[model samples]
Target: MADLKVNIGHLALKNPVMTASGTFGYGLEFADFIPLDGLGGFIVKGTTLKAREGNDYPRMAETPSGMLNCVGLQNKGVDYFCQHIYPQLKDINTNVIVNVSGSSPDDYAECASRIDALDNIPAIELNISCPNVKDGGMAFGVTCAGAESVVKAVRERYHKTLIVKLSPNVTNIADIARACEAQGADSVSLINTLMGMAIDIEKRRPVLSIGTGGLSGPAVKPVALRMVWQVARAVKIPVVGLGGIMNAHDAIEFLMAGATAIEIGTANFIDPSVTIKVRDGIDRWLDDHGCHSVREIIGCLD
Candidate 1:
């Protein structure tokens, strides 16, 4: 078998396959469908300092080849996660990364600090770029200064593998990524759903209640790959490529373009067992190429 191990900072993953946050809820919801240990890691739903009810109804819309969501980082808050969710996750053998989000730097720091207390969670994916939330989220991810401020504050409070999830909505994603690295981000994840909207001509209304939502799935794959490639070259730290990853082929494309690891997002909703399929497919691909290590194909774009 090919060696599928890879490292994101001090945290070591058995493979390069992980499930994206929001798409995977607390990593427990899919327990029956997938073997949790087979995954490199699974980022739980977005957690905040306080529980958010999220936006009104009609938060999801199905696009041609993708889906749009304005879920608004709905969660039961960090306290609930630490008190209730942590116990259930503590025994899991695989890496459990928390997807931390907030409206302010203090919120991010406080949440990260709280998750840091969890013995099972080895890393935190700082979500400074969630477009669905009207208060903060992607607000802090669009600008260099905004990204730096949040990351800097979290770095001081939370000590672990700090992975900042970057927003693709920005003009220069590389600049924002570089700022996160400068502020002590251990790793970076890219292309967190591009902003999109759909119309209901018959009703003369917007499909989603929020009018606009973040788009994911195969439609955004090209843009996601381009951003991942650019950001990977721009940052020295590892880059977790996500967005529009439906199969192992799509995942491999991201790896060759320059992602250290790939996260399956919308695909999980279509097939809960997709994570294992991607992982197995990658192993087969690696072995077929006579590559002993999955790392051999990473950034081998030439």
Candidate 2:
């Protein structure tokens, strides 16, 4: 079998396949059908300093080849997550990276502070992009200065691995990656969910009540691959690429393009065991190529 271990700053993952935020809930939800401990790490839903009611109905819309969501970082507060969620995941033999969302720098810091102090939670993925919210989120991730400011403040309080997830709705994604790196980000996750929308022609109204939402799935793969390659070259730390990754080959493409790791999002919705299949497929591909170490494929696009 091919070795699939990879590192994101100080955190070491068993493999390069991680689930995307919001899609996996708190990792506990998928523990039965999918083995959470078998994968690299599971990125839990977006947690805020306080509970969120989310937006109105029609928050999710299915597109031609993808889906749009305005989940609005809905979740129980950080304290609830630590007190209730963390304890359950402690028994699992894998890292549980919490995906955090907040409206202000102080909110981010406080949430980070609570999670960072926890023993079970190993990393924190700050969700910088989510178009379906009222307060902060993608608003701070699209701009370089905004990304830097948020990352910097969180870095001050969070001691564990800090992975700043970035939005694709930017002119220069490389600049945004660099901004997070400069602010002490241990790693970065790209292409959170592209801002998009779908209209109900029959009803003559927007499919989503929010009118617009973040898009994900196969349709965004090529665009996400390009962004991943660009940001991988720009940043010094590892980059976790996620946007339309469906199969093992798709994950391999991201790795070749420069992603140290890849996250399976909408694909999980279609097939619950997709991540393991991806892991198995990658192993087969590596063995066929006579490559024993998965690291050999990273940035091998030359």
Candidate 3:
């Protein structure tokens, strides 16, 4: 097998395939389908400073070739994660990352600070796409200033591998990525679901509880590849890409577009063992192509 190892800042991955936050449900939920340690890493569901009840009923809607969701970062809060979840994940023998979200810079920093105390957790993917309550519900990742504030605050407290998850609902995503890098972000992951909506014509109403939600699936792979390519050229820090990556071919496209690593999201719902499949497929492809390592194809696109 070809060497598939890659690094995101100081954190090393056995392979480039990782399960995205929210879709993977803390990694433990999928234990029946795939071995937990077989993955490069698995980011748990979105966690905040305090507990969240999430959105009301009908928070998810299936669309053509994709799905929309406004789950609203539901979780039992950081303390519960540190107390109950950490112990189960600490000895899993794979990288366990926390997806940290908040309404303000302070909340993001405080939540990250608490995760920093966990010895087994080597990284935190700072989710800046959350609605900023202090700023009239606008997401902190839409603008450079907003992205900077949260990254700056979190960087000050959390010292490990800080990977900032960028929102696709922005005019210049590369600019927002640069802002995070300026604030000491160790890495950046992109194309965090595009804003989309579905309507129920028969019922004359919206399909989801919220009128709009983040879109993910094969429908978004093209846009995600473009953004990953653009941001990869713009930032010096490592770029992690995700959005509709369903198989090894899709994952290879992201790596060629300059992503050091890629995350599997919606595909997990369709096939629980997709992560392992993608990882193995990547190795097979590399061997077939005469590449000694997966890194040989990363950014090899011309």
Candidate 4:
């Protein structure tokens, strides 16, 4: 069998297949469908310092080959995760990483610090790039200074494997990635849902309640691949690629584009079993190519 082990900073994944945050819920929700232990890692929903009700109705709308979501960062706050969610997750066999988000630098730091206290949680995916929320989400992700500020603050308080997710709605994504790296980001996940929107022709209004939403699906794969390639080249840390990955072939495309690993997002909504399928597909492809491990193809693009 091909060696599937891959590392994101100090956190090692069995394979280069992980589930995108928000899309996979808290990992426990999908327990009935796919084996959580079989995954490289599963990032939970975006947790904030305080509970957020998120946006209004019609938060999600289906588009051609993709979908738009303005779900915001609706969660019950970090305290709830620690009190209720952590106990159930701490015993899980696989890597249980939290997707941390906040409205301020202090918020991010406090939430991360709390999660760090949990002995079972090994890593965190900082969500300074979410487009769904209005106040903070992607605000800290567009500029280098902004990205560095949030990362720098969290890096001080949170001493775990920190993977900062980057936004695609920027002029120079590579610069943003480098800024995060310089500020002590262990790894960088790219192309976090491109900014997009749709209008209802009849009502002559926007389909989403928030007026705009984050787009994800096969449609954004090419753009995602391009950004992943650029960021991967710009930073020494691992790049977790996700935007519109649907199947194993799409995941492989990301791997060749310089992503150390690929995260399944919209694909999860299509097939709950798609992540496992992608994992198996990657393993089979490696064996077919006579590659002993996934590391051989980490940045094999030519």
Candidate 5:
């Protein structure tokens, strides 16, 4: 079989297929459907400095070819993760990454600092799309300075593979990516759900509780592909692509477009075994195309 190994900063992956944060539910929940180690890595749900109850009811809604959610980064906080969750994942024989989110730069740094103490956890994907409470609720990822501030704070404390997850709502995503890189980001994952809303025409109100939510699924694939391509060219670090990648063909497209690795999100809800399927399908496609390694196709587009 073609070699599927790849790297994101210093974290090596057995393959390029990883389950996205918030969707994979700490990686343990899907153990019945697929082997935990079968994945390149799995990012656990978003964890903050303190416990969050998440948004009110009806936080999710169905879109045409995708889904919208405003889950509000709900989790039991980092201490609980470090105390209860870390032990179970430490010996899993695969990379277990933490998705860190917060309302301010200090919050991000402190949460990352705690996760940095976990020996088995090699990376943290900073979710900067969170509202900046100090900035009147503007997301830290929408502007270069906001993105840099969070990364800078986290970089000083977190030390391992620091990946900044970018927001698609920005004007020039590449500029935002460059800002993260400037602050010592090891990698950048992109297209973290597009901003969208679904209206309940019959009820005469919005379908989601937050009025708007991040969109993800088949409908977003094209836009995500374009953003990955642009940011990959702009940054020197590796790029982790996500947003509607459902199968190997979709994953392969991201690889070719310049992503060193890709994450599977919304698709996991439809098929629990999709990560393994995509990994194997990538190997099959590589062999059929006479390629010796999955890396051969990364940024192969000319």
Candidate 6:
């Protein structure tokens, strides 16, 4: 087969397919549906310093070829994750990337520092871009200064490979990507659910109880690809791209556009096996194209 191993800063992954945060719940939920080990790594749901009840019941809403989520980062806090969840996943072969979020820079750094103590956790994905939260999440990702502050703060506490997941709602993705790079981010992952809303027009109401929610799925592929290309070209640090990647073709587009690796987000909710399918599809396509390795296809576009 093809060599799919890739690097994110000093960390090494066996392949380029990873399950996105919020989509994959602690890597244990999908064990039966898809082999967790087949993935290079996967980010568990957003973990905070304190457990959050999340938003109201109507947190998830379906849209045309996309999804809007105001799940409000409903997670069991960092200690619950590291103490209870991490042990169960320690035996898994792939890397475990912790997705941590907080309302303040100190909260984010503390979350990272806590997860960093776990020996099995190879990296912590600083989620400065989760649009579901009220005050901090996406707010920290929209500006160059905000992004830099969170990254720099986490850099001091978390020593493992740090991947700053960026928000697509920003005015300039490359500027924020560069800011993260400058703040000691080992890698950057992009297009974390665009800010969107669904309306019930009949009652002049919003479909999501939280009003505006984060939009993700095939509807965002094009914008995500463009941002990934721009950010990849702008920074020397590796880029992990994700935005509505549902199939092999979409995965290839991301690799060609310059994503070192990719995360299958809403696609996972549609087809839990999507990530594995993409991995296999890329391999088959590589075989058909007379290419023996998957790395040869990464960032191939001019």
Tell me the whole-model lDDT of each prediction, alpha carbons only. Answer: 0.92, 0.88, 0.94, 0.90, 0.95, 0.89
User: What TM-score does structure 4 among the candidates reach?
Assistant: 0.97
- Give all candidate RMSDs, comma-separated: 1.7, 1.8, 0.6, 1.7, 0.6, 1.7
Measure candidate 3: CA RMSD: 0.6
> Where does candidate 6 stray beyond 4 Å?
130-138
Give the poorly placed runs of model 2, Cα more than 4 Å off: 130-138
Taking all chains together, each candidate's TM-score versus the true structure is 0.97, 0.96, 0.99, 0.97, 0.99, 0.96
lDDT of 2 by residue, 1-302 (tens): 98999999999999999999988887777767878889999998899999988888889988889999887777879889988888888788888899988877777889999998888788999987633234443488888877877798899999999999999989999999998999999999988888898899999999898899989999999999999999998888999988898899999999999999989999989988899999999999999999988999998998
Off by over 4 Å in 1: 130-138
Q: How big is the RMSD of model 5?
A: 0.6
Please report how far candidate 2 places residue 144 from its true position, in Å.
0.8
What is the TM-score of candidate 6?
Answer: 0.96
Query: For candidate 5, lDDT tens digit of each residue in 1-302?
Result: 99999999899999999989999998999999999899999999999999999998799998888999999888999999999999989999889999999999999999999999899999999999999999999999999999999999999998899999999998899999999999999999988989999999999999998899999999999999999999999999999999899999999999999999999999999999999999999999999999999999999998
Tens-digit per-residue lDDT, 1-302, candidate 6? 77788888898988899988999888788999988999989889999999999999688888888999999899888888878898898999999998888888888999899988899899988888743244544488998988888899899998989999998998899999999999999999988999999898898989888899999999999999999999999999999999999998999999999999999999988888899999998888988898877789889886
Model 4 regions more than 4 Å off:
130-138
lDDT tens digits, residue span 1-302, model 1? 99999999999999999999999998899999999999999999999999999999899999999999999888899999999999999899899999999888888999999988888799999988743244444488999988888999999999899999998888999999999999999999988988899999999999999899999999999999999999989999999999899888999999999999999999988999999999999999998899999999999987
Greater-TM-score candidate between 5 and 6: 5
